[model samples]
Every structure is written in C-alpha cells, then in structure tokens.
Target chain A: MTTSNLHAEIARAIQAAPLLSPIANQLLQVTARADHEMKEVIDLVKCDSLLTARLLRVVNSSAMGLVHQISSVDHAVSYLGERLVVGIAIAECTNEFLGKPLDGYEGESGQLWRHELFTAIASRAVARHARAPLPADLAFTAGLLHDIGKAILSEFLRGTSRELVADIVRGDTADYLTGEQERVGLDHAEVGFELARHWKLPEALAQVIRHHHHPETAEAELRPLIYAVHLGDILAMMGGQGTGSDSMKYHLRQEYAEHFTMSKDDLALLLLECSEEFRKVEASLASLKET
Target chain B: MSQMVLGIGDLGASNHPDAEIKTYALGSCIAVVLLDPQTRTVGMVHIALPESKINLVKAKEKPGYFADTGLPLLLQEMARHGCQPKGKGLIIKLAGGAAIMDHNDTFNIGKRNLLAIKKILWSYGLGPRSEDVGGTFSRTVSVSVRTGEVILSSPGRPNWKI
Candidate 1:
C-alpha cells in the first residue's frame, strides 16, 4: 500500500477510536496549564463521583499503607498527587487501548501499560533535571500516552515482527521506526500523533507522541520537555520494561545533552530511582486494573 | 514442573530437580545464571546496572539490581545452598546486556554491563561458560535445574541453548 493510503486507513482507525471520558478530558486540559491549581483538579474530581471514589480507593489501597482511612476527596487527591489521579482517570477511560496486547510486537496484555507507566515515572524524574523550568507532571502525562498508536497499529502490524527485525538487521531500515514505516507505510509515532489530534490532547503532548524518538526535531521551546519523555522512553526499555520486540530497537538521540544536563552517574541514579518508583506506582495502580 | 520467574533486581535459587528458573524482558540488564549439576541447584540474578555506588541504599535493599552487589549476593546464595564455585562442577552462563541503536554511544549500558560482569567474575576466578549478550533485542532467559540446560529466547527467534 502507498504511504497516503496507509495514512488514510490510520485516519479511519483514529476516527473509530474511543474518545476520552469527560472527566479525563477535563483533567488533562486543566493539568496541561502551567498556572492550574490543585483546587481546579480537586473540583474536577469532586464533580465526578465515580472518579472520586476510585481515587479514594486507590489512596487507601493497601499499597498506599495509610494509617487511617481518609474519606475526603481533597485529602485523597492531595495524598496521591496529580500524577496518580490523572493516571487513574486515563486508565479508567482507555483501558481497552492501554491493556490490550501488542500482537505486532509479540507483546502480552498489560505489557504496554506497564511500559507506559514506567516511562511516565521516568519522564517525571527526568523533568527535574531540565535546564529550564519544566512541568514534571506534564512530562508524566506525555510519557503515559506516548506509545498509544501501537495499540491501534498492532493489528495492522500483526505477523510482521520477523520481517521488521530482518529489515533492520540487513540495513534496509535504520531502526525500528524506519522499519515500521517501510513495512506499514506509517510509523507508530505518526499514527499516535493522529490519535493525539483526534483526542484533542494538549499540543505539548501531541508533539511528544510524535517526536519522542527524535526530540531534536520538535519545536525549540518544547524540545526540553520532549527530551524528558524521550529519555524516559529509553529508560523504560533499558530497565527491562519494554512492550516487546521493539523494546530497545530505536536510536537514543545523543543531542539530549543540550536539553538536560545529566552525567553517566546521574543517569544511573535516575534509572535506580525510576525502577524503585515504578514498582510502588505499578502496585498502587494495579488496583485500577481490578476495578 | 514449577517455574520461578525473576524480575529485574531479583535473585533466587532452588535445589528441586523439577524446577525451572527464568527472567523475562532483559534489555540492557544481564541475567547471571549459576548451575551445580551434582546437587541440582540452580540460581539466577537479574542485574540492572554495572555499579551499586549510584544508589547504595537500593543496593542494600535490592542487591540483585546491580552487577557489583548482585553477583556477590548470588555467589553467597549459591554457597548457602551448598553449591560452591571452588570446583569445576559449577557452571556460569550470561545473557542480555543489549544496547539500543546509537552511534554516539550515549547510554552504552549494555556494553558497560557486560564488561562489569566479566570483570567481577574475573575477580572471583570465574567466568561465563556460555553467553548470548550484546544485541539490539530483548531476551528471555531460562534454565532447567535438573538438566542444567540454559535456554535463551526472544521475540521472533527460536529458543537456543546457551
């Protein structure tokens, strides 16, 4: 199929894809703003009783290890922070996409979610090292949704893992992203960008979903934030939390040095920290899966 | 037969003949597998980084997460299980330590991890008898306790004994 034809098929797929729940959409919009207050987030949660209850349940979940039950939504949201709140809301709305198996990559069900969760945590950590002020939570959100295109593109890529790997090995393609483009006429990043547009996600997040593999190409102002997610994505794969065959198949753009100042030791420490956080957060969010 | 799966920074040993020890999704991390055929004792540690000094606290809490700390702890666990490396009967095999495609060698963690493991083993007068390390792919490694058979697998690849 021609590249244009493939994009048209993906366009149709994005159109049929589920829209974010009202609460999730609102939460994302509110959190994307730099000056948004915790009150705004709490107010949004309070309006959706179901989300409020889920948030409270997660806060009091044994994974949280609370001494006493805190019944107030305000207390729960405060305790869990915006990241987990947004994570729960997004997971609630997009379980089908996040939880499904990536057959094209030979990934198991829930693997993609695990990878994204790790990336989200890692990206948040990387944001702290930005040369300029960057919203760590925004990076978290971007990381969480970075690979969403894979969920929709998996079926179209089914049974192509070997062919893709072979193409990469023989130098027919530079990397997995290129191999994906060569085989399917469109890469997951492009497809994900389309879905981001379909969901009307914040522009920063849409840019991240598209250029996370090559942050150098993103807009100069957004490059730092995109670099955070880019490094986070690599950190996830490096820590053994990849989706599947495409695990570490992408290139690590070295230009990240210009955006974030991290020495080798710093990178190692960040990986350690991300690994520790991923375990705790994954355990806490596993409750969301049960509900 | 029962199987025990090791996550990153985890280690375990078993003496049961009908046991299998495995670790999955080894990207740049390395799995150090130890087998003692006579006692049917097998052990594995999934090491995530080359050094422990980067995070001493985590090293103390999860020794299996770094090459320096985890390899020594795995050796200690083997000793506790009555499997000594002093004799030739002990077998060491390594897998994983894969690098992402990169020209600048930024985050050449896979190469660093492989070197670290080899250096640590050399200090202990031990080395891997077989290895399947350093690639751009993730690996799932397993070992059969009874047969001391080490098997390696990855997506779109056949299982091969290393």
Candidate 2:
C-alpha cells in the first residue's frame, strides 16, 4: 500500500485539537501544576467523587473476586498506592468518554473502553515479564490512556453512516485515516497523540498515541514499552478479553519473541496468565456501578 | 523436495514450494516471514512480545516470549530441520503492527514492534524482501514456496501480490 502521511495527519490533528475538547486542558492543568504528583493529582482526583466512587467500587469489586480480597477504597488505595490509583481513575474517566458509540470503529460503543482496559492490563503483564521499571499499575495507566485521542473522536463519529463503518471494519490506517483527514483534516491517532502530549502525560506515554499503529515508526525511546502495549492489545483481542472492531484478524512479529525470547508456548502461557489475572480483578470489580 | 512449515513461536509458515504459508491480522504483534528458494524451505513467526525482560521464569516457560531468546531457536529449528540458509537464498518478509486501536489511545505497539524487529534483523544481517508493516488495520501474509512469491491481504482490498 502507499505510505500514509503520518506527519501531515499529525499536524492537522494538532492544530485541530485546541478546538476539540476541554478535558485535555482540564487534565493537563492538574497533571502539570501537580507534576502529576499523586497527592496533588489525587486532590484533583478527589474533586471527582463520582469518578472516585466508581473507581473504588470497581477496585473493591475486582479485589473481592481475587484470592486477595480488598474491601475498602482506602485499603485499595493504600495497597495499590497512587500509581495504580491513576490507572483506576483513568479507567473511570474513560468509561464515560467511551460510553458512546465510535463510528470509525464500526459503531463500537464502550467497546473502546473495554478494549483499552484489557490492553492496559495486558501491557502491565508484559512489563512484568520484561522487568521494565514501570510498575504494572503505571504501565497499565499508560496503556489505559494510550488511546485518549480515540475517545475524543468518538463524539465526532457518533452518527456516521454504516458504509463508513463498513469501510473502517474493512481495515487500514489508510481507510480510517483517510476519512478523518478528509473530514477534520486529521486522523484520530494523530489527534490522540496531540491530546496526550498536551495533557503532558509522560512523553513515553504520549508515544503510545503517536506510534501505537506503526510501532516501527514510534519514537526510539518508546519501542519496548510501546511493544508491550502492542503485544497486550493483540493478546487481548485474540483472547476475547473485550469487545472491539478489530479482534478476529491479526498476527505477531517474529522478532518480538526473539526480542523477548519467548516461544509460542510462552506467548500462550502469558495470555493465560492475563486472562486469569483479569478474571480475578473483574470478579472483584464487578460490584462497581456505572457512573 | 521437502515442504517444511516453520512454526516460530506464535507464528507458523508453510513452504509447499508449490504453495504458500500464510498468517493473518497482525496487531501490535509482528510476523516474520522467511523463505529459502533453493532449499525450498520457508517459515514464519508470529511473535507477540519484545524481549523477555520481565519474568524470565515465565519467559522460559513460554519460548515465544522474546526476540533474543526466540530468534536463535527459530534459526536452530530451521537448521535442525535442514532448512538452514544454505543457499536457497533466504528472503525475509515482515508485516503486521496494526494497533487496530480505538481512536483516542496510544498503546502503539505497531510502530514500536516494527522497530524492535528491524533491530533484531539488522543484528542478524537479514530483512524481508517486502513488508506492509504498521497501520490501524490488520494484514495477512502468504508466501509461495515454488516461486517465492509473497501475497498480503487486508480488509477493503485484494491480496497485495508481490
């Protein structure tokens, strides 16, 4: 296929992002002034009691299902600390953002959130395997927010036609990117990347939006962690961990195994581990009511 | 004269010489397609992760866990099976990395994965004849043993014949 102009699309999205959502601005203010300092962030976080309640409820719910039962928000917070708290908060926030259907992703609604959550968990699992310094919670938080742009775009795609969805379901960054570039002069990925950057999400985290699709072209610093998220996404889709428009068809790179030194059995086992872990967490979190 | 199917980690490829070995829908994961004409041997790997830097025990348990640990074994598997790069002139083809992600997320494994694969291949002094790597869409790759012809297919388009 012809090469897609990621830069051009990114540029368009960057310019358009300011006109888009106030959420990016809101989150950035807290994260920046606070330097993402958890206490400060938590202070910002606390303002969203509904969000926190939702978060605590999910955490408590999921924990109850785990062999390690956690009953209270304070206990969960103390145990998981701020790192995981951010991930839970992100999950809580995005749940609303992705609540509507995404036209670009085949009218997928909340499917984005489900897909992202699975991917976030999977990213943490891979990070654990890689011995990356990122705690599973941190990796998960980054993974969870990796697709923030997509969430913003869902509103734009709210009432698009089935033909467009069909085209997207058919596939290609070109197909989906083209439509976005034509309409808003940028694709969601680029838009998402800019959103992440503006939010001052760690640059490493921002890279997820920039290169999640073309890991090969991602910034040099983010290759490994991005790869983990990538792998996590594949596993999540393959294992049916959540709903998504692109689940049934995909393959992995050979060097990933070579890069990580895992065999098929190893990959399979990792997948099993992810599933088991999610089940434990999900069982506990099932008590959470939607905000 | 022998048709060998190289199952490298999570990836598998068949060299029918008269047929093709194919893998589909690469998202964040990488698919390494290797073909040897003279040896009539072709193989592929559907690697799902980078390096096993996280849990070596788990990595050891699952061999398809890292490029460093898995690449050698793949070559060894090919060598042990007599599909060594002894002339049929090895051709490596790379594909996948369709993060296929939602509109707002980053989790960019596609771009990062292709980078890792490139580094490994460079270290090994090998690369694919062609590739359709990275995008928001999935891809399918098929290699014909007889002609060493590789075909890739994705949604909304026909198989990319090369």
Candidate 3:
C-alpha cells in the first residue's frame, strides 16, 4: 500500500475508535487548566452517579486501606485525588480499547493498560523535578493516553516486528519510530495524535501524543511536561512494564536534562517510586477492569 | 506442579520437585536463576536496576528491586530453602538485560545491570553457568526445580534452554 493510502486508513481507524466518556472528557478539560480547582473535579464526579460509586469504591478499596469507610463523592475524589479519579473514569470507559491485545507488537491483553498506568504514575513522579511549574496530574493524563494510537495501528502493524527489529539491528532505521514509519508510513505517535484530535483532547495532550518520543520538537513551553511524559515512558519500559516487542526500542533524548533537574540517582529513585505507586494503583483500579 | 511467577523487583525460591519459577517481559531487567541439584531447589530474582543506594528506604522495603540488594537477599532466601549460593551443586543461569537500540543513550541500563550482577556474583565467588543476555527484545524466563533446566522465550523468538 502507498503512504497516502496507509494514512487514509489510519484516519478512518481514528474516526471509528471509541470516544471518551462524557465524564472523562470533562475531567480532562478541567484538569488541563493550570489553575483548575479541586472543587471542579468533585462537582464533575457528583454529576455522574456511576463515577461517584466507582470513585468511592476505589478510595475505600482494600488497595487504599483506609481505616474508616467514606461514602461521600467529594471525600472520595479528594482522597483519591484528580489523577486517580481521572484514571478510574478513563479505564472504566476505555477498557476494551486500552486492554485489548496488541498482536502487532506480540503483546497480551491488558499489557498496554499496565504499561500506560505505570507511565502515568511515573510521569507524575517525574513532574516533581520540573524546572518550571507543571501540573503533575496533566502529565499523568498525557502519559495514560500517550500510546492510544498503538491500538488502532496494531492491526496494520501485524507481522512486522521481526522486520522492524532486523531493520533496527542493521541500522537501516534510526529507532522503532523510524522503523514504524519506514514500514507503515505512520508511526504510533502520529497515529495517537490523530486519535487525540478525534477525541477533541486538550491541545497539550495532543502535542504529547504526537511528540513524546522526540520532546525537543514540541513547543518550547510544553517541553517540561512533554519531557516528563517522555522520561516516564522510558521509565515504564525500563521497569519492564512495556506493551511488547517495541519495548525500549525508542531513542531517549538526553535533552530531557534541560527540562528537568533530575540526576542519575534521582532517575533511579523515580523508577522505584513509580513501581511502588503503580502496584497500589493497579490494585485499586482492578475493579474498573471488571466493569 | 505449582508455578511461581516473579514480577519486576521480586524474588522467590521453592524446594518442591515439581515447581516452576518464572518472570515475564524482562526488557532491560535481569533475572538471576539459581538451582541446586543436590536439593532440587530453585530461586529467581528479577532485578530492575544496578544499585540500592538510589533509594535505601525502597531497598529495605523491596530489596529484590535492585541488583546489589536483590542478589544478596535472593541468595539468603535460597540458603533458607537449603540451596547454598556457593555450593558446587548450584547452577546459576542469567537471562534478560536487553538494551534499547540507542548506543549513545546515557541510561544504558541493560548493560549496566549485567555488569552489576556479574560484579556482585564475583564477590561471592560465583558466576553464571550460562547466560542469554543482550538484545532489543523482551524475554520471559522459567526454571524447573526438579531438572535445574532454565528456558527462555521471547516474542517472535523460539523458546530455548539457556
């Protein structure tokens, strides 16, 4: 197939992809703001009875281990915070898309969700070291949705892992993104950007989905958050939570040093912290998977 | 037969003859498999990083997360199960530590993890009997306690005994 035809197919796939839940969409909009209030998140959950229930359940779930049972939506959202609330809403609405098997990458069902969850948690941790003010929760949301394109592109990429790996080994392609472009004419990042646009996601998130692998290319103001998600993605893969064969196959832009003030020791600690949080979050959100 | 699976930054040992110990999706992480033929005991540690000094508190809570802390704790676990780390009957096998494609990457964790594990093992006068490490692919590894055979499998690759 020609490059234009492949891109056309990708556009169609993006159009057919599932849309985010109303609650999730609003949550993204609210959280994307630099000065969004916690009350806004609380009010959004209050509007959705099911989200309220899930939020309460997750906050009181054994994974959280609170001594007292809390039944109030406001209390629940406050305790779990906006990131976990957003994660719960997104996971609940997109389980099929997020948890599906990635045959293209030889990945099992739910692998991508786990990898994204880790990246979300890791991105939040990475945000702490940002040289400038960056909302940690926005970073979490970007990390969570960073690889959504992989779901749509996985089918198109079927049976290409070997050729891609071989190409990478022989230096015929620079990295997995290049290998992907060489084989399919569009990489997952670009595909994800299309999905983000289809979902009418926040501009910052669309930028991240498009340029996570090469954060330096993103607008200068967004680099810090983009770099957070970038390192968070790498940290997730390094922690062995990658989706599949393409694990750690991308180039790590050392320019992240300019965006964040992380040292080698800090990076190592971030991995440990992220893994620890990922365990608890995965357990807490297991109930969402069932729904 | 029972199967024990280790997640990243985890370790375990078993003495049951029919037991199998395994870990999945080992990208840059290293899995150290220890088997004792005399006692038919097997152990494995999925190490994610090379050192413990990065976070002493985490190392104390989950020593299996790093090569320095995890290897020692894994050996001690083996000793408790009657599998001596330095015993002649012990067979040590290493797998995983696959690097990313970038040669200039500062976080060359896979190579650093391999070097760290080897250095730690040398301190105990022990080394792997065999190793299947380094690549751009993730690996899933398993060891049989009864036969002391370690097998490795990865996506798009055939399963092989290491």
Q: Please, what are the lDDT tens digits per residue for candidate 1 over residues A1-291?
A: 777887788789889999999899999999999999999999999999999988988888888888999899989999989988999999889888789899999999999999999999999999998888899999999999999999889888899998888778787879888878877888899889999999999888899999999898888988998999999999999888998888888988888888788877887788888988898888877786675
lDDT of 3: 0.87
Best candidate, TM-score: 1
Comparing candidate 2 with candidate 3, which one achieves the higher DockQ? Answer: 3
Query: How do all the candidates rank in terms of lDDT, highest first?
Result: 1, 3, 2
Judge candidate 2 at residue B120 and give its lDDT. Answer: 75
Q: RMSD for each model, in Å, please? A: 1.5, 12.1, 2.0
Higher-DockQ candidate among 1 and 3? 1
Q: In candidate 2, how many Å is residue B160 off?
A: 24
lDDT of 3 by residue, B44-94 (tens): 999988998887887898899899999989888988987765545678899
How would you encode candidate 2's per-residue C-alpha lDDT over B97-124 as one tens digit per residue?
Answer: 6554442122454565577777777777
DockQ of 2: 0.03
Quote model 2's TM-score: 0.50
**Deviation in angstroms for A112 in model 2?**
0.5
Which pairs clash (backbone N, Cα, C closer than 3 Å) in model 1?
Answer: none
lDDT of 2 by residue, A212-242 (tens): 6556677655676777776776667644433
Off by over 4 Å in 3: B103-106
Candidate 3 lDDT at A120 equals: 95
